[model samples]
Target: MKSFWCEQAWLPDGIASRVLVRADRGTITSVSTVDTIPLGCERLYGVVLPGFANAHSHAFHRALRGRTHSDGGTFWTWRDRMYAVAERLTPESYLHLARAVYAEMAIAGVTAVGEFHYLHNGGNEMGEALRQAAVDAGIRLTLLDACYLAGGIGQPVTGVQERFSDGTGERWAARVAELREDGNTRVGAAIHSVRAVPRETLSLVAGAFPDRPLHVHLSEQPAENEACLAAYGLTPTELLHEAGALTARTTAVHATHLSTKDIGLLGSAGTGACFCPTTEADLADGIGPARELRDAGSPLSLGSDQHAVIDPLLEARGLEHGERLRTGERGRFTPADLVAALTNHAAVGWPEAGRIEVGAPADLVAIGLDSVRTTGCAADQVVLAATASDVAVVVSGGKVVARNGVHETLGDVGKLLKAVV
Candidate 1:
């Protein structure tokens, strides 16, 4: 059992002062107001929000961060470089790299991450490495094992693409069934994209893991939509809808390039949209219709895809910034809405998390208001004013995993990343 006293906490009702939270075995037991701090209770100053959930991530891409920005190149060119790195990663090497990457996320206030893993190398070794990595980092993980069976529409697997394919959807499902989940991990399903998975196999992958969360790489580029439309005579969104892949349990990773009808199809089906604002911008992927998707019944979530940046606070801020730039209006999404998206654990199969109420996971992120970036900001509006540097203390599953931008158990995250990358 453990107790924490927050100077100010973002409770479900509203921000409360002098709040006390109790936890036992990593689940929040009780929450109430307190006049004074009790002995042995950890004191957390500033505003304490629920730990951020990175709804979309590619753990191995952390290595491609600053290395791909030298020459101006298109997303296709970036893929060649990414594939080069993917081909060289062994299970042992990936375990070390992913551990540092996840530890980096921990210090940035992410308590759970949804890893869109496709670098299987035709087995579950890489998947097992990711599971162990998350356990060592003291954060929850949802491995969205992807099904990749083609190089492109009507194209055969070639070069490094051969490493990603499992011959057929049946083979993909059989291998995925071998991946067992533990207390710190959940196994989920992903369709690599309309380009990788053919029309015939889409439905099989969609229904393969009916009880778990489903994620997919939506139209992040205009070329992808062009190819999908030319090949199937339908938009990628339409293709997914035809396959019965759009559902409340499904999340579209980068709904960037979409037709009006495409948006309608996704929105009407109660699917979720996960916008990676940093990665979208970094990779030259256009800003997605975030506001429209939200109003269309699709819940919104945020992620630091590709690890161009791993700060959920920045992603939350970028989400609003992108909307404002697209619509020529400010406050497209209120701070509360941004916070909701930042801590949307349900998008990653952890529906019981991302809230401060009892019965949720005991995940808390204390953001210091005194930081230079957030000196005069209101507690509720800190999502716009602060960055990951303001995260003073992080508690995941009732344990202090990071303090003041440094991982508790791993010490200097920079050193860890340096040793691996």
Candidate 2:
């Protein structure tokens, strides 16, 4: 058993002061208000919020952070450069790189990550490397094994994209079935995009993991929409819907370019929309209809896709900021709404995580109230003002894995990232 006394904590109802949280094993057992500190209990100062869940990520993309910015290009052009990096990643090299990347996310207050993985390299070796990396970094992972059978609509796999293909959806499923999940890991499925997977195989990938989380790259680029429309005489969303891919357990990543009917189909199907605001802006992908998606019934989640940035707080902020820039309005999403999106563990298949209540995973992230970026901000509104630098302590599964941008076992994140990338 363990206990922690927080200066303030973000409870389900709202923020509370002098909060006491108790954990047994790796689950939070109780939460309450205590006037006095208890002996032997750890003290977490500042404002403790539920650990963040990164709903979409490509762990290997961390290597391309500063490399791609020197050139001007669209998402497709940036993707070509990304393929170069993907081509160089052996299982051994990827293990080292992914460990460092996951460690960076750990210090940034992400307790869980949904890796939108597609770099198969012929087998599950790369996926196994990722699972080990998450364990070493002290975080939970959902390896969303992707089915990438095509390079584009009506195109064959070429270049490094061949590494991501498993020949057929059945082969992809057979390989993924070998990936066993334990306490810290889960297995999920992903459609690389409407471009990467043919329409015939869409149902195979979506239905492959009927009981697990399914994520797909929706219309991230205008070109993708045009290509899908031209190829199928239907939008990508319509195709997915016709194939029975849209469902409650599905999440559409970067639904940036969507029709009114597309949004309605996704929301009415109870699907989730994961917005990668930083990546969208970095790749010049347009702002998505985040507010409209939520208003139409789809739950919203946030992701630091491509690792262009790794801060969940900043992702939440970017989500709202993108809304403001697009809608010309303030307070598009309330503070609570942003917090919910940041901590949406269910979107990644960990339904019992991302909250500080009993039965939830013992994940707590303390953000410094006195930091230069967060000073004078309201406790509830800190999601709007803070960054990863303000994270003082990150506790995942009842263990303190990181503090002050330093990992517990890995030491400084800079050195970890330097050693690999």
Candidate 3:
């Protein structure tokens, strides 16, 4: 029995006004753009939009944002530094770190997150710690419990990365199932990449998790592509397709070095590409043909991978910005497209149905039209000009987790980060 009205709203098509939205049992019960605000309903005077869904995230990586940029190196060198951070995490430490990081996402107006987690072997306590962290942070997590058995296509984990492996594919599935949730979090599956997971292991993961979401890191590096081609005589995309992992529920993260045929396969299979713009740009992972993928009818989503950047507005802008840089064009997507990716398409990575329509979860954000980045801006300007700091209110599943520019879980984050990171 919760209801609210916004002065302006982002409907499926365009900027709308006088939107009367009702919620019951956390689902959006009704919506009307032409209706007047109810006399006693809670109302927010700003441009209200659907909450952003982060299709991919590594919560613990938020600790490594500034530390990884000093050396101009490939993803391998970055992995060394990343490994150092991953090695130091105990379950308690991870929970503490993740709680803070998820709060930051809430403030950024990201309601649900798909965490591609692989740091598994600190023991059973580590599993408990990750689960608690997701709950404390208020993000409905799809803990894509990853099967990372090898260092490359043919090599086993040799050093710090060994902890990410769960010994065998059977053990990996057991561990993934143990990281479950019935209420808040939805546990999902992940193959760290074709490099980290062998061909037999790929089929094992797919066979274990039938009719569920599967995510994998694909073609993010030239080395990975070269290694995959050398090992399998096929591109990473083809290897995956050959293993029968390409499906509508499958999500390919950082799909940068794909061929035209690979793109066509992904489009035809109805698989989604999750673009982690800032992380890809920071790592020099090459531009993903997002515009090409979109034109091919592949659904595109966004993620704040590696926590190099946490702003969905900035992520949306990065999508357009990358397009403009490639084509020398302005406004690659209308505001509606930007909003849809953040809201609807990104939701494909999660369990909940997204939209302001009936039976959809009440995950929404109310942007402050009067904020510094929003001054003299309409709903379109919010996407074009605003940052995460401009997000004023965040509501998820009929619960208010963030309000008035602050999240309920914001305190102690700076302190928790300083100790572990």
Model 3, range 1-421, lDDT digits (tens) per residue? Answer: 8887878877666668888888888788898875556787767678888778888888888888888766687888888888888888887788878888888888788888888888886445665666677677676777777888998878879887788887789988876766556666776788889998998878888667875678888899998989988888999899889888888888889889999999998888887888888888998888888878877767878899899989998988898888898889987887777777777534334545557666778777888878777899866668888888788778887667787656766554456567656
User: Runs in model 3 with CA error above 4 Å?
Assistant: 33-40, 122-124, 345-352, 409-420
Off by over 4 Å in 1: none
Of 2 and 3, the candidate ahead on lDDT is 2
Q: lDDT tens digits, residues 1-421, model 2? A: 9898999999998899999999999899999999889999889998999999999999999999988867687777898889999999999999999999999999999999999999999998999999999999999999999999998888999888889999999999999999898988999999989999999999999999799999999999888899989988999999999999999999999999999999999999999999999999999999999999999999999999999989999899999999999999999999999999999999999999988999999999999989888889998899989999999999999999998999999999899899899
Give lDDT per model, in order. 0.95, 0.94, 0.80
TM-score of 3: 0.94
Each candidate: RMSD to true structure? Answer: 0.6, 0.7, 2.1
- Tens-place lDDT digits, model 1, residues 263-317: 8888899999999999999999999999999998899999998999999999999
Highest-lDDT candidate: 1
